[model samples]
Target: MRIPAFLLAFSVLGGCAGGMSKDECLYADWRAIGYEDGARGASASAVSSHRQACAKKAGITPDMNAYLAGRDAGLREYCQVSNAFSIGARGGRYYGVCTGPEEGAFVTAYQQGNQLFALENDLAHAEHAFAAAEKRLQEINHNIDHAEAALISPATPHLERVDILADLKNLNEEKQRVKRSFGPLRRDIDVAYEELADYRAFLAANGPYPGAHSVTSASY
Candidate 1:
């Protein structure tokens, strides 16, 4: 059975920083470990990490030739164009593993997917800012209403009424400023949404990678 790209990528990239446990080092399959690391696009220094871990815990050394051979084989699977897009779209980092003829296409797809990732973040930030502004405006309006009521109260103390009047003036000014901010905030949100939509459409039509299906909401 085939694995979903996201899940595969997650498995490859997740929980990869730790050193081998004592048990793991004692009964290690160096080649398999190397293959797993390479499939995740780990740096070449991964073998050094494994060597250090094993030497410290198990008093053993990794088979250098076996590890390199396995890593090379795994890199062939990892450096595919489609995999690059999948990784990049998920905001996963690339380790510069692809080389030779396939490198150009793989890099291109990765960059394209990365663009989509960036656009998604941009839209999210824009929407968040707009929402925050709207909330602040609501709060300002509420404060203004309360201040206005306090200023006009018939039995209010003279000194308190003066303070309330001053507050009302400041609140009105702040409300106007917040109201004016709405225009630019809304424009920012609209522009971000449109830019993200346009990029998504472009990817859908052009395909994120060769032989891949059209981009969809799930792709993000």
Candidate 2:
């Protein structure tokens, strides 16, 4: 069996996920590898990368015919609107693998799922920003209290008192600025939650994409 030259030449692996490990490569089944990628809706380009991995690790040559056949079977599992929705919900990228009537429907459903994902992420980001801002506010308040204590101390020098007061002023200004942003952040969170709810309701009414055969670690 002839191995592809590109597989033998490239040793560096990057963005080539779920390729054969050293052990699997030693006893490689290229068809099964292809099937897994197809099932996961991975691009056709994955074959070249996987071939490289197995070649570099175990000096094994892939049977391209078997791998192509397996991938075709796997594509049957991947090409469905329901699977597309799930993939988008989990923030996975689609490679537009399906042809025929299924492609249009799958892309439509996937877009809605992607919208939900975006909203969810936006809400999460806003919440994190707000929490971090609030934490900073608390830290500033704590510092101000300490500075106040130092100012009242009879042993404290005049210059130190002046500096402490100036620090307190700056901290208060920053606190006010953060406080101003809080309302907008809350609004953003609320908007995202509403949009997410709408998308969820839509999918709930419209979906469950087609593949009933679940992919598992054992399959890999």
Candidate 3:
């Protein structure tokens, strides 16, 4: 899509305790951090992770008031239709950060983008599964062929020949299993492509959501 310079997705690595580094805890800027988090569409509860991180590592606490103020300002920037659209296209989730008209507009756009992203993901995953299954089927068939040849070999022992027969039977079963799985994967790919086409047609007819300027974090 037509992504803008400022609307680019920024990487925000966060996990337990907000995954803040020692340096970030020591040099914490509540306002700036709040702004960044807000821009990234972090939920209000997200601050708790930071709070815990800071408290655990540095024995300090975040400035809640300052952080909230900064977050509000950042949300002002993040609550834009254009940013929401980009976020959705990139398969990003919204945290209900925007309110009022901005909230409705952003969410609407985000959902549209998310639809396309989801379909693309399904298509990719289905394709990958189908390819992997095909490879496995080939391997099983080759092994079965070799086993059959060995079974009839004059040098093969009777007991060993019996084992080979069993192996061949199991291999055939596995091949059947893979073929069964392939059917679904193939179907999934078809469904994904169809849905994608529908979405593309809708977009072409309606155009993208109207763009709006909002402040968002470099990472959101």
Best by TM-score: 3
List the candidate numbers ranked by TM-score, top first.
3, 2, 1
| Alpha carbon lDDT at 187, candidate 3 | 90
Candidate 2 pairs with clashing backbones: 82-209
RMSD of 2: 8.3
lDDT of each: 0.80, 0.71, 0.77
Pick by lDDT: 1 or 2, better one: 1
What TM-score against the true fold does each predicted structure earn? 0.79, 0.80, 0.81
Off by over 4 Å in 1: 1-14, 56-60, 145-170, 211-220
| Evaluation by lDDT, superior candidate among 1 and 3 | 1
Best by lDDT: 1
Instruction: State residue 18's C-alpha deviation in candidate 2, in Å.
Output: 7.8
Q: Write the per-residue lDDT of candidate 1 for residues 29-135, one digit (tens) a residue.
A: 77777677777778888887788878888888888888888788778778888788877887989989889998999999999888888888888898898898889
What are the per-residue Cα lDDT tens digits for candidate 3 across 1-220? 2323453344244423457887888888888778777777788898898888888888888999989998887787777787777688888888887898667777888887787688778878888888999999999989998998999899999999989999999999998999889778889889887877777666665555555333222222
lDDT of 1 at 122: 87
Candidate 2 C-alpha lDDT tens digits along 89-150: 66878887888877887887677567667777988898898899889889988998998999
